[model samples]
Target: MTVRFFNFTDGQNVKLTAERGGYSVIEYQSDMSVNPYEAQLAYFASKMNVRRRQLVCHLDRFPSHCVSMQAGAMQWMSGDVQPKTGIRGAGDFARKLVRGSVTGESAIKPEYEGTGIVTLEPTYKFILLEDVTDWNGGIIIEDGAYLSSDASLTHRAEMISRPSAAIAGGEGLFNLGLYGNGLVALESSVPREELIVADLYDDVIKIDGSLAIAWSPTLQFTVERTTKSLIGSAASGEGLVNVYRGTGRIMFAPVATGHVSSASTGA
Candidate 1:
């Protein structure tokens, strides 16, 4: 089959920002071709630094590296692609349903197989591709951060060490966990370039807010006071803080990074 794309492949409108583990991040340099009014709006949006970016995953038929994305995330696909709901049976579906309820993720993420190119919906949020192995083969992400992952990974709901602590920390009781050796895509308000990665060995790290985007599952997370005593905490002008103990890696934003609208927000 032969196909030709004008401004697209020519890099006039979009450019490849980064690629990793079969996935690529494409950033739009201009949004001036949608329509007359919309193009003008997009031009202004770009000037305001609100341009859209997209994620694309590639698969090979010879040694296929199938991927599962957030439900309804696929914008387009081509070249002998087949999609499945990732529902093996009724029991499995029930588990996933419960997991979705707790983790704030979709009950059934659709998986795409065979040789093809899968394009996900674009958004203003920054796109990140992380190596799961770098997190010791397991990582837990903040709610609504998940975007896509390799089909070989095991995705599940990871409960907090203390539910009350999670609530006190302004985080969910459970987080979405991705395990195995593969790449996981995430959407974040803070770009990966600005993330602060801290690795601890049998130690502790504390943050005054929920600035962490992802952390190793091996670490124990909790909510604690900045000082040992309530009087001391008040004197220090600090209250509760999110604390992570044990040996693990954490990627967090040094400053407060607000959330961006996501496709799977209400899904």
Candidate 2:
């Protein structure tokens, strides 16, 4: 069948809008009647420079592909769509549980299939659509970056090779890894335009903090002192820093994300 969006707005109190991909973003316009306090807050927020929340919906047509999403992320599904846990047996469940524990992700993600539309629960964080193939077939993402992905892709948790990396880098012990070819959705602190990408050729890149959102799984991550000598490290005024070495690519959000919290936007 045909899909159409009517009277959709982009930016400036957007009520509804669709991107190039099979996804649509929705936002609530400020209205005094709904919640006067919130409306007033939103109005002043505009003045104070706070961003509005936006929600995303995945639209599927007949003979469409399946999508796997974070647990409890589905807001609603319509038409011939079906949901599955993608779990085969007890062994799979146990493995997923371990992965979830280490990666700090949901234990079980639901897969949606068939010819229908599925909308995810909205969040204040920015939504990013990326093709896994663009990252040389594999990508390791920071914890909680995952939102959804085409079912054809494989998901797992990858552990840091060195314990010191986990403890000193401030990036956690394990990260969510995605493989294969498919479209993936991510919840990012910053929008796509603000993101920076670095491609390495048997080289190294270092960051002062946990700013890299995702990186090629082929790269090695570790924590290192800014200078080789202790006196140099002290004089530099910077201590241990996260470093990515080897030939691969990395995507980073230069801005800090500590203050951002997840909040839902209705479909």
Candidate 3:
């Protein structure tokens, strides 16, 4: 297979470069990553647009950039909003407010109250996107799957209420697959190298940590505890397992340094 990179623009203020191959790689300047999407929503928005769900995905580790460069990328993100509906707020701005007791966060709240909707919150410190909560489409949570929808649809309600952990608590959990159209939130452990696609045939794949971010609703999952006989998982540490089988695309972190924030205790 031969691969070559080329730059082309349709003469808009926007220009992009794409690499060609069996499949084309088109990356907007990481700077304009959020803009093109907003333009698409704007051009296609409708009253029933409220029924069109938007599934937002964020990479836990944002693309690397230097001081000044990072600021430029964030500025591009700031202008990406073009919601014809609800009130919108900045994630960082909302975070500062959520962290602080500032009463002003409500000042920048979304412009409307019902139906047409757009809101902002952080899936992590890096990713932020507006999801059309009023839509009826079931959401596929890849990351920030914790965010919820206020739309009439019931599918995303699972994610809106719980994160990946919800699956364990009798709350039907899996990589959110939408049967109907509506907005939903998804959490993906690995976003850069993995994708969540659905296949008619069901297959199950499991991994170390909760790498199976999202999958179709048809897959069945079970938890298993490992005995001390299993190598490092038993001797050096503990082996906990989550087995998933069925058909669907699972997004897994290529590298599994699974850990929670290890804060130092003043021992």
The Cα error of candidate 3 at residue 186, in Å, is 3.8
Model 2 lDDT per residue over 1-267, tens place: 565555544544565533635555665454323475577676875454345444354536312368888888887676677789978799989999999999999989888887677877757677777777899999999888888887778888888877775686566888999999777788887777789999999999988988888999999988788999879988999987888999999999888866567544543
lDDT of 3: 0.31
> What are the runs in model 3 whose C-alpha is more than 4 Å off?
1-119, 122-144, 148-150, 156-179, 185-202, 226-238, 256-267
Model 3: per-residue lDDT, tens digit, 9-126?
Answer: 2323222222111111122222222376575554443221111111221211112110111110121122123322222347645543442232111212221122211223212111
Query: What TM-score does candidate 2 reach?
Result: 0.86
Estimate, for each residue in 7-43, the C-alpha lDDT of model 1 and write its tens digit.
6534777888888868888888776558776877778
- lDDT for model 1 comes to 0.84
Q: Ten-residue segment with the worst summed lDDT in candidate 2? A: 55-64
Task: Enumerate clash totals for all models, in the order shown.
Answer: 0, 0, 26
Badly placed stretches (over 4 Å) of model 2 are 1-21, 27-34, 46-64, 263-267
Candidate 3 C-alpha error for residue 93, in Å: 29
lDDT of 2 at 188: 82
Find the candidate with the highest lDDT and give its number: 1
Candidates in order have lDDT scores of: 0.84, 0.76, 0.31
